[model samples]
Target: PFDSYRDAASTAPGTLPSPAAVGDLLGEAGVGSDDTIVAYDDTHGVFAARFVLTALAYGHEDVKLLDGDFSSWRQEYETTDEVPPVEPTDYVINTLADDAPIVDREAVEAAIDSGGTTLLDTRNEEEYEQRHLPGAIRLDWMELVDEETRGVKSGDAVETLLADRGIPTDRETPMILYCNTSRRLSHTFVVLRSLGFTDVAVYEGSMTEWLDADGATEAAD
Candidate 1:
């Protein structure tokens, strides 16, 4: 289904909804635990990826984004107002995995201090040059996905990009990724995992919380 008001099993704009709230919305939307969800959005994979990540946080697995998104779908097929049949399921969130997909500000800072975790900054070049976390491997979110159609780029495209930049290619490396709201970073997180990169976490606090906490930032020379 297209990314619409109905697709949002959570609150809108700026930040993610609470775990209980997301479970409630998804449960009512008839998303079962065993089901596979393909979330897509017109605003790029930004919102689409976020929805999948949120589902994972609430203990829902087997979800993925429609790689090309709704724009690609519309380009090929006629639109319809008909809605799919939905069976409401009482989806209670299972306890989170021991290795959660998210990390907090303090955890990130500690990781940076210890040099055990790498930070992948997913903001734009302008913002990256203006200010960024020290030692963050800069990668603008737009590069991972298309600008016009908002569809995700191919995995080979990203692999080549990372390799050309001399970025680390190890799968077991610990990494924390972030964007303005951590929304865009989710896309990269998924792509990296698909390429076999492990121990990746999304810093949901992101730059917004970093600034709020008066964390240190570095600028381009």
Candidate 2:
């Protein structure tokens, strides 16, 4: 079955599905332990990570994230107007990770005030224009990987992207990335870690919680 979180969210009225529900949904969709599953979202990889973690929790293996996400896929590859059909298979449910990978509003507030770190916002320009956490710089995720932005032909693409944004890559500075929901941010996390960024972590709840709060610091330009 071609299950979508967006669809579930609309019907269920929640940001995420319960772990058991996710397992049941995937199982009903026939997702098997051996299946090579890929999950993605346009906002950020937080949602994808949830799904991946859910699959792993339910004992499913062979899961991988789609590089660059759906938008990037469309930009890189041409597709036809017609939709394609999908086949469903049984999936085994295995749960992993005791807690959700989410950092709360208070943690973000502390992180911003403490300094000694670079706060990167991976949302698009339009979203950044609406609002963002205080001291967070908009780094638009696509710009990081685009050949035109950094123009570097080789080594450590993530570092090159950060450097292009005037962020130093030395290990001394801690780096934290966040987005509306952290789906794209997860991809950023993966890229940065691969490029040897040692002190990096993602703000899981991200701007969603910050913006929803009563008096959290938020700015718009």
Candidate with maximal TM-score: 1
Give all candidate RMSDs, comma-separated. 3.6, 5.7
Model 2 per-residue lDDT tens digits across residues 1-221 = 22443224532222344556666676666666567888765543445654664454345556655554556567767856895654555543344344333355676677888877688888898888777777787788666554432221245555666677788778656777788765567556655654676777666556765566653556574
Relative to the unseen true structure, what is the C-alpha lDDT of residue 146 in candidate 2, on a scale of 0 to 100?
A: 47
Model 2's number of clashes is 18
Cα deviation in Å at residue 85, candidate 1? 3.3
Expressed as tens digits, the lDDT of each residue in 44-140 for candidate 1 is 7777777777777666778887776777788888978899998888877645556669787898889888896778888888889999998888887
Best by lDDT: 1
Give model 2's TM-score versus the native structure.
0.61
Clashing pairs in 1: none
User: Would you list the C-alpha lDDT of every candidate in the order shown?
Assistant: 0.76, 0.60
| TM-score, every prediction | 0.88, 0.61
Candidate 1 segments exceeding 4 Å error: 1-16, 147-150
Clashes of 1: 0
